[model samples]
Target: MRRWILLAALWLSAVTPACAAPPAPPQRILFVGNSLTYYGNLPATFAALAQANGHAVEAEMILEGGATLSERLADGSVQTALAGRRPQVLVLQERGGDLLCLGGRQRCEQSQHALQGLAEAARAVQARVLVLGTYQANAQASAALVEKEAAAARQAGAEYVEISQTLADLSRHQPDLPWYAEDGMHPGPALTLLDAIKLHHALYGMPEARTLEIDAPRYGANSGLQAVLRRADAAAPNAGTPPHIHYEHAQVERLVRALDHAARATDPAPATPSSAH
Candidate 1:
């Protein structure tokens, strides 16, 4: 009777299907910066890119035009966002030249202090912190700024991702490409696309080739994406408005490939020793 019972159980087990594990929750990333971080709707663009690559990701941002990290910190908006969202990753971007101490010692110190405070808050939530270094039109002039930003990132116990080198390389190869808006300081649509791709790579590593074939029309139709576009359009500095370029499916694929190549060519900045912790 025992042998018959065991045989019956084994038969039932063999015929029944095994239960599958539930899918993982999406990775939550928060971007904290100014117009440079928002132009061309970078957060939405990044989310779209991750979706294309089969990654479940949620990207959000807190941005104000010409606002530095210190100002944002003082305003308490960043803190409120951090508390409410509890994102897994926090990306910090300082206004142009502030990290380089170009705005005098007082301003530079304020920026650094703000960055450290923000980093601590992120760490408290067990979130990884990343410092995104911006680029200038003049690569030679921006080199010093990039180094300063990288050093600051390390001091704050965060990882640094510098896009200046990649942008410079692209400028050399694709001179006709519009990397800057009419203002010449802010990023245009092409540059914004590049930024999104690089951020995607930084957060999730190199994407597969198949993921580069994004459906541009469908991506543009996303409500979140449209909202960002409107924000960027309204925030254009002076007469320097972004062309608001829209890519076709084929164009998007090609542009993504080119941007990916550029990103791969320029290695990411060395991570801070504490970033691994």
Candidate 2:
């Protein structure tokens, strides 16, 4: 009897908040980004998180790589082409490859323009704005970019959610954090998990956890079936799929397979982000 009581206490401690749920909801979200964002499985991370937490989710990511927010906003390109559907949130981040443009004369100005466009879109669709500040790189490392984006969001009366820096802080120690991918352009699998963890902290009030994607389309069109764990994004709304797919016998056919491997191999998936609110 006493032994059983002690075991229950230990189990409860293990499942407590910090070791429990993160604080975000794995709900409907839309990500607007470039190649890096695509690789992170931006939408699928949330979807995966929802599954972990025993919830259903819907998320999407629009391909806009190498194009800064300013560039994407121009010509009503990204926002205009969204098919007029507004999600609960729109995540905007600078192009990872654009790190080379950091400190350039036009960086700040371009970011501002992009912020304006994002604000306009958010307003038009009644959605919130999640500014994915620049990732950690030699030239583009600074809280200013995030601050400026947040300022613009506030000015425009848009709610903001920050992630880059927090992840940076976490990455400083874990060098193998997968902050960079093989291309040296986008974040590898780790960053996506980190983003999901942070995002959970934002939307939910649960404990915290990072992820390792088990499934994905391909590392790139050619990276092959590697053991990477990034996030996955959903196709655009009302977006149709290809005519057919072949999944007969692949060593590792898709990202989902990788996730399956992870679940079978390592510890269980982190609990879903907190969904208290």
Candidate 3:
């Protein structure tokens, strides 16, 4: 009887599955930017992508149309937002041309100083700082801007993602894709999706983000996604709306796949350290 009981216990132990570990807490990320960051609801899109990829993430943003980093700092909204809940990551984006010195040296210096200050604040909460470089219409100008922004990010001891270079490279191969909004300045849907993927890779060090297929039907039902699409349509009602706004579920999925393929195929410019001066 004892031998039979022992044999039964061993069989049960061999067949029983081990308990699964609990999931990790969601990573909190905050974005501080203007229209470029909010036009397509980037933070929300990022959260959606993270969800699709099985990464637990909480994304939040503080934005105002045409607002610059200096303006954000002066308004104290960022500091207020950072007071209680310190996110795991903080993303900073200056005005479109501020980092390019397009507004002159003094303006650019102000922008840099504001970025450094913001970086310091993020560090106080033990958060990683990511500076997003903006794109310009001219490829040469965009490259120059990326270099300048990279230098500033290095000075601030933050990681820089040269989204300008990424967009330029992707555009060369996928010219039909809408990279810019109706204004030809702000980011369109494709660029926004690519930006989110780049940021995800920077944070998580996963190339899989570039290849994940977005579920168009599920994403289309998402309120955040719908709102952004509506905003895009509203911005250019007379222009017959961007193709993305009218894309069927299947077409949306195809577009996302194509963008992902393009991103995977292109090699973004590596971030290099630059002289702070």
For TM-score, the strongest prediction is 1
| TM values, all candidates | 0.77, 0.60, 0.74
Off by over 4 Å in 2: 1-27, 81-83, 96-103, 138-140, 206-277
The pairs that clash in candidate 1 are none
lDDT of 1 by residue, 1-277 (tens): 9999999999999999989899888787888887687666666666666777778777777766677889777877777777877888888888988887777999889998999999998898888898988886676767888888888999999888887877887778877877877777787767777777667667776544433332222112112321121222233333333334354455456566776666555545532222111
Pitting candidate 1 against candidate 2, the one with the higher TM-score is: 1
> Each candidate's lDDT (Cα)?
0.70, 0.53, 0.69
lDDT tens per residue, model 3, 1-277? 9999999999998999879899988787888887777665667666666666677777767766677999877877777667666788888988898988998999999999999989998888888899987888687898898899999999999999878876887778778877777777778777777677677667653323323343222112112321111211123322332223222344345445654555556646543322110
Instruction: Name the candidate that leads on lDDT.
Output: 1
Q: After TM-score superposition, what is the CA distance of residue 176 in candidate 1 from its true location, in Å?
A: 3.3
Which of the two candidates, 1 or 3, achieves a greater lDDT against the reference?
Answer: 1
Higher-lDDT candidate of 2 and 3: 3
Taking every candidate in turn, the Cα RMSD to the unseen true structure, in Å, is 6.1, 12.8, 7.4
* Candidate 2 residue lDDT tens string, 166-208: 5555456557545667777566666665555445445552322
